[model samples]
Target: MATGIPRTKWQSAPHHIQPNGLNSGNTDVHLSYEGKKPELEILNTPPANLRQLWPSNAGHVTPNRLYYGDNLPILAALAQDGSVRGHVRVVYIDPPYATRSVFQSRNQTDAYMDLLEGAHYLEFLRERLILLRALLADDGSIYVHLDDNMVFLVKAVMDEVFGRANFRNWITRKKCNPKNYTRKTFGNVADYILFYTKTENYVWHRPVEPRTEARAAKEYQYVEPGTGRRYKKVPVHAPGVRNGETGKPWRGKNPPPGKHWQYPPRVLDEMDARGEIYWSPTGNPRRKIYFDQSQGVPVQDIWLEYRDAHNQNIEVSGYPTEKNPAMLQRIIEASSNPGDLVLDCFSGSGTTLNMASHTGRRWIGMDNSREAISATLRRFAKGLEPMGNFASKLESAEREEESEDTLSLFGPEETAKPSPAKTDRHHAITDFALIAQEPGADDLADAVGQWLEWKGESRIMQFREETVPYKTGKPQKLHRAKRRKQRR
Candidate 1:
């Protein structure tokens, strides 16, 4: 009999019942459920039949790809593709949260159905995650966005797949404004993102935000008498006793109990001589940190600024559940650098792909929903309208009165005027190939046709035949159609 603590139904199940041969020795705990497929079975999913609708521009090697298909087979195909497998540097997915509701675009078009629940949804996500893991490079990173509905359960599944040691951060984001709930529960305005790395060594560019004047004044209250520089004082001692020179006393003063000098005795003496150390009225020493020397405040896990479109002033793709572009920008900038491959299998509004492209990263986006594909295509072709407040703010800043005699900490400020604001509203998307998973699929063709009609174009580009190699089964032939050129 199991003692000490009672196990839940999932935890009490036999070790052999779980897929992937998960056991106590390998994984700490597993979420056992009926109809769970083995990892091998999931990874062996049939590769998608692929055909390119539009070829990339000349001299553009490794062009971006957009796929219209079920992401499971698409991911599997990518995992087997020589150029993509083990080459993806970043993956950001905002999958359906098993809300059991039908989502539609702002124009009343059906986007997708999130009907899966219980063990079925878990299995569905796990299958895709396995393939995503296979596509990740050794130093790659992934961020999974979800809400409270199924984030906890998925967290467990991710731990099993990505290994517990690779888990980085459980970031919380304020998704929307506060809601006045009629129910007993508190207002639901936040969601979560689970960040994980493929290995111990992963690419990371630390994200920082500009320090606001209010925050700077509050944090750096002290002003130097001679230099007029804003600064703050921090403790010169840190926790934990040491046996090195830092543990020894300097200037006849020892480190406090259970503490050690942050610097060596000689280093502290040099800093004191250079006036980098501050002496308190009571004679306590602290190191001075200047505000002008700081790059910025390091961003924290709880994000409150990058909220979703709430008011009419915010510009969006009209896709239901579209994420903030700024939020995606931060994630892409932090995880990957220029020319890195970024993958988003559940690319709803193509926000991740757009941000990746804007940041000079290669991107691949896949989605099965016709509405989603259409929205993404429209976003790429005709850029979203600039945010109402953003444009107005820029104009106002540019119109600010320029003064030549403005005083500064050092001396009078120079008479340099702010640069003119860029008013171009469209994003010039790099050339990318639009792929259809099945040859002559009516749904995909219809989506593309709708997009062309919306853009006032009559000609339809023909799809070029291509075969995606598979481990098992013969390659299927893709449908070929004649291209129709637009009338001049």
Candidate 2:
């Protein structure tokens, strides 16, 4: 028998080593279970039949998209579509956490069920992730939001799907206030977001926050005597030894032992000449960083300021498990640029889509819950109330003392303080197409019909009615009831 290729030649094969020069050993380190299918099989899964809820008109701009269906099949269809195959820039998903509970809305209406557990849940997410990966652009990023219950397990699955090398940050966010729990464990007020990239090259805009007065005072303590500017001095040398000019002595001094100057001698001389360098009496040199020149402090992994709405003054869609809009704003700004497509498959109160629209990014949101759809539509039509400030009850009491006006929701008493105009509050995009998948599209149409009837003239009229045929080869028309007289 012919002798097999030499070991060196086999090891030198392209498949044996990754582009980054890391050895990709033959052994596959992946999670294996009874129901896990091959990646190829998952990719080949049948695509769903997407039916537009309304016909698009010429007046509409580049309309965003909203889907009402199971995300898996919808994602499968998107994966095969040439336009969306690899064009999505950002994806943020907050799927069910396998808590085995039925989540409801504020009115006790059933929203969704999270009954899958163990291997079944794993497979469920794995399949969707595989399709999402295919739909992601080469320079794209995805954030998977989850609670403590399934974060660790899902992290492993994410590592397997997105590759361990592509993993970015496990961002921990304080989702709520302190909880007084009877359980033996610590209070669970934090949730995690697993960030990942499609490839080594990805879009990233650094996020920063204005430093607090206390923090600014603590960090920029030194004040320049001449310019009265707040500045901080840092070491002029960096770690590591160099044999070039950076290691050479400048003037009468050299870099500290085993270290090198951060800049070349000529550059250091320029900085010193320009008054950007500080010199000590002992002949040590340091770089001066001015507080006025700084943009702000870099945002870190730990987040504490983005707690959920806990007060009645904060306006919300009344959708259970709704997230803070500011949190989604930060993520959208950091990971994507204007006009880039942002997707959220588990679009619960449509917070992601709303923020994306507000931030000038195109978005696509999908959810299977009928209640979620109704809530999202209503939020888009009726603007959210402005958040009221209650930093101190004394301040509020003082304001009340100054004015005899009383705030009331009914009668002439409402004249004291009217709600802010719709232009001042957050509202949904006027142009977006709604789509529902087949087999259940008819039912979704009926539900939407009822919602439109309930809303009457208040319903958004941007979308024109259309008769779309589903898989059953039957055309379903969205009906609107006659306007009901306003109640006294």
Candidate 3:
């Protein structure tokens, strides 16, 4: 709990190297539990400080947004200003599950959460969730997609952040078909989506279908009394009586209990003549709701819509990390009506934004990987539809000083050429420890050898470098400073 530099660790140094934000230049650095294995990166920022992460221009109305940086810093930067403060309607993230599977691009393994069981994974979600909660609207929702490995931990964190009363539902998603994982415990066929709302009365729009077959079977199950088409029936009455109208009583034995006719005599007569009315068994008259007429069923917590991207020709772009659009479409439709903004900080493959497009919602997405960002840009560019209202909205909003893109991931410039070679150039590095994944004797020696020759020249022992080996849960790399001299 103690945040200050301890006297033991403080006194060891001449007192000049401590961070100016924490230890005053005069505070002796004494070695303590914190000092023995202190975290180097998490400095200066106070955990208690509530950061206000918001978009810069409030007037920009473009439905698309992509950020290329750490969500933490973005949140921290937002803390100083509340422009985007308290305005988001929904949020979704697919964080690293702490499985510790290092993602590789060119033989360099990126530090990712090891999905194997661990506590650090939970803390990571907890910290990010806390920041995310601050950015939510009063009546907003958050959906976190996680695996069995850390679902419980992530859920507990959300319960604490959003308050237990706001905890909505744990969504059971069919990720991999049971046929594939039949050998594992429980077949490992599904993943979990933890839903949390900011308040009880959050945005609750019922989902309307795109005239899909399943909905056709469900809502359009009944038949019209006259047209003989499958149709759902609705009572055509209100609870209260109206004024100045001849309330039409159809060839009916009075309206349903406590209800009055919805239309006046003339309108009821017209509908009756059109044969849109259905005489109920109770001798009450109702209206025929056409099958081709109704929207989709209200989306539920249990999702079965999206299938993971497997085929390259599936409009999925088959990027290394593409999310199913159906999954996000449901989330967007359920939480926001048309034109409302949705947020996806970990917007890998732009599923959230893509769904926003199909469903007519506005959205913003952000990610740190250049490859992922490029993929998203390419997806949009490939579509090549005229920007239309979405583009006009963006321009008008900017004129009005509204929703502006702060770190515009894409500027006026076109896409850059891909990195020519995907191979690990493995330039000679002096301190191989600086480039190692783990501190194994084998990889460490190999890594150092690469660093030394990292410059393409033969091994050089005294080149100045910037990186110190990170404390990667193993022996830290020890690269004492070397004197740099001019080499002809």
Give the C-alpha lDDT of model 1.
Answer: 0.76
Off by over 4 Å in 3: 1-65, 104-117, 178-181, 210-293, 311-313, 337-339, 354-364, 377-488
What are the lDDT scores of the predictions, listed in order? 0.76, 0.74, 0.53
Backbone clash tally (model 2):
0
Largest TM-score belongs to which candidate? 1
Candidate 2 local lDDT, residue 360: 88
Write the residue-wise lDDT of candidate 1 on 61-120 in tens digits.
444888887999888877767667888999999999999999987666889999999899
- Candidate 2 local Cα displacement, residue 112, angstroms: 1.0
Writing each residue's lDDT as its tens digit, candidate 3 over 313-389 gives 13443344455665676688788878676888777656676667666666667665544554455454343122221
- In candidate 2 the C-alpha lDDT for residue 289 amounts to 91
Report the C-alpha displacement of residue 162, candidate 1, in angstroms: 0.5
List clashing residue pairs in candidate 2: none
The CA root-mean-square deviation of candidate 2, after full C-alpha superposition on the true structure, stands at: 11.1
For residues 5-35, what per-residue lDDT tens digits would candidate 2 score against the true structure?
3454344446755676775555556777779
Pairs with backbone N, CA or C atoms under 3 Å apart (clashes), candidate 1: none
